[model samples]
Each structure stands twice: as structure tokens, then as C-alpha cells.
Target: MRFKDKVALVTGGKNGMGKAVAMRLLEEGAYVAVGDIDELNIERYLSDFASKKDRFIFVKLDVTNNDSIRKCVGNVIDSFGKIDILINCAGIMGPVKPTWEITENEWDQLMNIHLKGTFLCCKEVISYMIKQSYGKIVNVSSVSAKEGNPNFSAYSAAKAGIIAFTKSLAKEVATKNINVNCISPALIETRFLMEMSEEQKAVLLNKIPMGRVGKTEEVAALIAFLVSDEANFITAQCYDISGGRSVY
Candidate 1:
């Protein structure tokens, strides 16, 4: 129970890696506030953890909107007393199209959710973390950010922005006992993969030296460690969970 008595706020906690992270935290005795845009799905997902009811709460969140993020954070603080950890896991894979074929709206959507959303969440939570004099934050980036995947220009660019954001924020708060870091994953096996074509999938699979896509649970385990007290010395770092695909 590394996180016993701690409070964690997780965006996009309804499904995928976000959901996995939330579950891991709860099992380790943390109070988790799950924020997502899908209320029904969040409710349904929570039902699976009937025994863990007291460990978690659900909030409807739209990460791109400052008002929504503020309200969600407020609700979490009101319920849990303080936010000790933050997992910025809310994201969407925008339409898969060639750079020139992608529309302005699609590009905006990607940036709004992946880049601006992460910034907004971090901005709102850092104040409370700084006040407490201790906190841990994990932003989810992508291998595409470092490797620059073809046909996913918007996602790659936005994820790259996250790495830069995390590094700058980590340095700014290093003396305050706040650890800021990010994970760069490649082609994880999640519902998110449903949107990809066989060709797109092949392109990504070919790059993994381990010869397999990563599992959400494996990434969640990494996150669990990063946010725990065990990682106090780790900050301003971007850990790669890309099945040996990361050159760095």
C-alpha cells in the first residue's frame, strides 16, 4: 500500500490506460477521483470495483475546457481533502490522415485534447500541490513524440509538446518535493487501436523490437511506481514504455 492515505486525481479514468492506473492506485490504498467525459461508462466501470467503492469517486470532465477542469478539480478536493497525485491520461487519437490531407479542425481537436488539455490540468492541480509542499504528476506522452510517426503528425507534435512541458514544470518545482514526469508509449493494446487500419497497425508493429504491442497493465505498473514515494528522486524524466522501440 505505497499510496495509503494519499489522494489521486486521474483524467480519462473511464477506460484504457487511465482506467488501469486508477485501479492500481485504489488497490494500493489511495483515494482516487476519476474524471472523464463519459458518465455512464465511468459509472459502469466503477461498478466492477464494488468492494473498492469508498476508494474512488467519478467526475464528468472535459479536459479541453478550463471551466470543466476547474470544476472537476474542485470536486475532487472537496471530496478527498487534497490532491496528492495527478495522472494526466485523457487523450484521443485524431483522424488518421496524411499531413496535407488532415483538416484544420482535426488538427485543432488533437492539440486541444492532447496538448492544451494536459496543460490545463497541470496548471489547476499544481497550485494545490505546491501548497502541500509535495506531489507527483505523470503525463502520458507517445513514442511518436520522439520518433515522429508518419500520418500521425498532429498526435506526434502534441505529444512532443507534453515532454517539453513536463521537463520545464519539473525543473520549476524540483525544490518543492513535487515530481513531474511523463511516459512515452508506442502502439499499446487498447480500444484506441480499433480506429487503426491494418496498414497503420503494421507500420507501428514493425518498429517494436520486442515484437509486440505494450500492455496497458504494464504501463499502469510504471505509473504506479512513478507516483509512489519510491520515485521521489525521479523528476524531469520521460520514461519510454515502447517495447524497445525508443532509441533514446
Candidate 2:
């Protein structure tokens, strides 16, 4: 049990990578607070972890809302007493429109969820971590941040901002023993890519050198390492989990 008694906060934990990581933590002995916008899947995901009644729970959360974050996280603290790891995995991909076709509202929507949501969640959790003098934070970034995608400007920009934020903010709190890092994955086997249109999917797949998409479990394994005692010295860096996608 690498994370025994540790409390983990996973955003967007109802499905995909977030859900995968949430389950992984629970399996590895951490009490997890699973939060997501999709109310329908909340019960389903929670059911899977029902056996671990003492270690798992669910909270309906809209990451973009600051108040929702405060309340949800506060609930976790009330139940678990402290937080050890936070994985900001709530994100969305806008339409495959050209940059010129991207609207201001689209950009703001992306920023609010991916970038701003991460900021708000972290702001609320970091204080508890500082008091405990220990914490691990992993923000889910993407390979698109490494190379700008043609129709993914909003998502790319927001993810890129996450990397920068992770580094500087990690440094700011490193002395307090709270390490913040980002995982920039290429293409992972998640719902986002699972339902992509042929054209949209083909364009993205052709760019990957691995000839296949990565699995959420693989990313979860890396996350398991980071959140464990082994990664104490690791911080202030974005660990790339891409399958040789960005050779640069």
C-alpha cells in the first residue's frame, strides 16, 4: 500500500483517465474523493469502488466553479482529515475548427475548465498540504502543448499554460515539501479519443509515431509512482508520457 491512509482528490473522476487514476489510487490504499460533472456516471464509478467502502467516495463537482471546488474539497478534508495528492484531470476538446474559426467564447470556455479549474482546485488544496508539509499534484497536460494542433488552439494553449504554471508554482512551494508536476500524454485510450470522428481521429493518429494510442492505465501507473513515496525528489517538471510522439 504505497498510499496507505493518504487522501487523493481526482477531478473528472467519473470517466476516462481521471476515473482510471482514481481507481488506481483506491487499489493502492488511498482514500479517494472522486469528482466530476457527469452525475449519471457518478453512481456507476462509485459502485466499482464500493468494496473499498472505507477508502472511496464520490462528489458531484463542476471544476470550473470555484465554490464547487471549495465545498467538494472541504468535504474531502472533513472526511479524510488531509489531502496528499490532487490530479487535475478534467478537460475537454473544442471543435476541430481552424484558429480563425475559433470564437472568443470557445477560448474562454476552454480556459475556464482546463486552466482556470486547475488553478482554483490547487489553490484550495495547497494550503492543507503546506500544513501537513507534504503533497503531490499532477495536472493532466497533453502532447498538443508540445506541438500546436491545427484545430486545437484553445485546448493546446490552456494545456501549455498548465505546464508553465506547474513549474513556477512547484518551485514556489517546493520548500514546503509540496511537489507539483504535470503529465503530458500523447494519445491515450480515453473517451475523448474513443468517440472522435474518422477525419478528426485520423489526423491526430497520423501524427503519433507509435502507430497506436496509449492506455489510461499506463498513465495511471506513472501517476501511481509520482504520488508514492518514491517521487519525493521529483517536482517542478512536466513528465511526458507520449509514445515517442514528440521527438524534439
- lDDT for 19 (candidate 2): 81
Per-prediction TM-score, please?
A: 0.98, 0.97
lDDT against the true structure, per candidate, is 0.94, 0.88
lDDT of 2 by residue, 1-248 (tens): 88888999999888889988998998988999988888874556567887997888788899899899988998998988888999999988766678889889998999999999999999999989998899999999888988988788888999999999889889999899888998999888888885578888788888777888889999999888888889989998888887888764
lDDT for model 2 comes to 0.88
How well is each residue in 79-127 modelled by candidate 1, as lDDT tens digits? Answer: 9899999999999999788899999999999999999999999999999
- Which candidate leads the pack in lDDT? 1
Model 2 residue 178 distance off true place after TM-score fit, in angstroms: 0.9
Which residue pairs come into collision in candidate 1? none
Window of ten residues with lowest summed lDDT in model 2: 40-49
TM-score of 1: 0.98
